[model samples]
Target: MKPLPPTLRENRRYLLLRITPATLEADERELYFAVSDAVTALFGDTIAAEVHTATIVREGEYLILRCRRGREDTLCTAIATIRSVNGTPVHLTTISTSGTIKALRRGIRAERKGNSIICTINEAERTGILYADEKIDLIRRDMKGQDVVFLTKDDMEIFHATTTITDGI
Candidate 1:
């Protein structure tokens, strides 16, 4: 069979997801299933197939999901509904979506060093605080038990103080 031409190839996007409950095992298959179920339940099999999610990478607390280019919004919606994987309560936070993997990696790296950060309290609800332009002090060596998650600009705004963002959500 002849391979399709470059122009005919499908455009894809890579999404970076930050996983919470960091203690849970990082199993690619389980992560894929949780994502698959969320999309299938929300949009049915037709849209689910159209999305074509692929779990490309799983680091300590990060997951790189690949999906059809234009379906990023759909993917994000599905991701938001996910509550658990393999009965382990978890949170999936969408960091970014990029058409190229190189760009996606760069964004994730920037996040690791980015000035904004979210500090999560060690509790059942896992309360979090979104801070602007600051991170180093919160994660200092003396603060041995701190749980922090780096976030993107969008996330920063979403999790920002409600008292300040009085504008319509």
Candidate 2:
């Protein structure tokens, strides 16, 4: 089968969003449903179909969503209405929007340019990464599962044995 030519192909835009709290365990399917529901709820089924919202890629706490190019505004509005996914409270902040996947991927790389610091709190090991505004994201993994904690630099300093600065993140 022949593929559609560039001019005949549907125009789409990719939106990069940063998921806050950044620790939600929701999978791609859950995220898609959440987005779909938000769009439908805000614009109804017909408009939702017209928007054709889809999840293109999910990397760590960043998500790339595809939607009809001209409908991006409506989609962004819908995305803002999404407050939770799978019963867990989450906030999605749109980082950037682009017509090419390459540009969006570059943005993701730029956003993840720093190494993470390792810390030991109450004898449990956790990996910490510094974010802007003096915020830190810590992830602790154990036999049970993974636990993610977001705290300020001041709060993290109170933890015990948080002196190690691991190399290569």
Candidate 3:
């Protein structure tokens, strides 16, 4: 009998560093700087050197950042994105939320209840949902007080906070 070929798996390690929540009215850019500084301080000049990309996504009520590393086979080569709510900066590492999500898409339980939806996201992912509806409302208002983007009942299952209309007038 022929043996199955060994599948190549990337040998990579990641670390998640979470920051405490700060005040709500704090500046977002400033908070990002602080979180970046903290990440640099924690990982030093070696592993956490390159920051490939950073993106902000709305999860439930909170804003989550996904930071992608340049390489996948290095120690401390990971992403760190943060959200500042009520003057609090919550740092979420790629390993904790993103990794977990990648591991168990079905394991992370979620269900809808009436007008509200309940998702069994991890404690860290929960950060993404923090202040979710309000933040989206703020963003919508900031976008000219139009209902172009909204949170609907179906969005609850996907953990997405904002919805947009590209074809509608």
Please name the candidate that would achieve the greatest lDDT relative to the true structure: 2
Write the residue-wise lDDT of candidate 1 on 61-85 in tens digits: 7889999989999999999999988
Q: Rank the candidates by lDDT, best first.
A: 2, 1, 3
Stretches of candidate 1 exceeding 4 Å from the true structure = 109-169
Q: Can you give the lDDT of residue 123 in candidate 3?
A: 28
Residue 67 accuracy (lDDT) in model 1: 98
lDDT of 2 by residue, 96-147 (tens): 9999989998878444443478877888777877666667778776775655
Per-residue error (Å), model 3, residue 101: 10
Model 2 stretches astray by more than 4 angstroms? 110-133, 136-151, 155-169
Model 1: residue 130 alpha-carbon error in angstroms: 18
Model 3 ranges with Cα > 4 A deviation: 1-23, 51-61, 69-96, 99-169
Pairs clashing within candidate 2: none
**Top candidate by TM-score:** 2
Would you estimate the TM-scores of all the predictions? Answer: 0.63, 0.71, 0.29
- Of models 1 and 2, which has the larger lDDT? 2
Prediction 1 TM-score vs. true? 0.63
| Model 1 local distance difference test score | 0.70
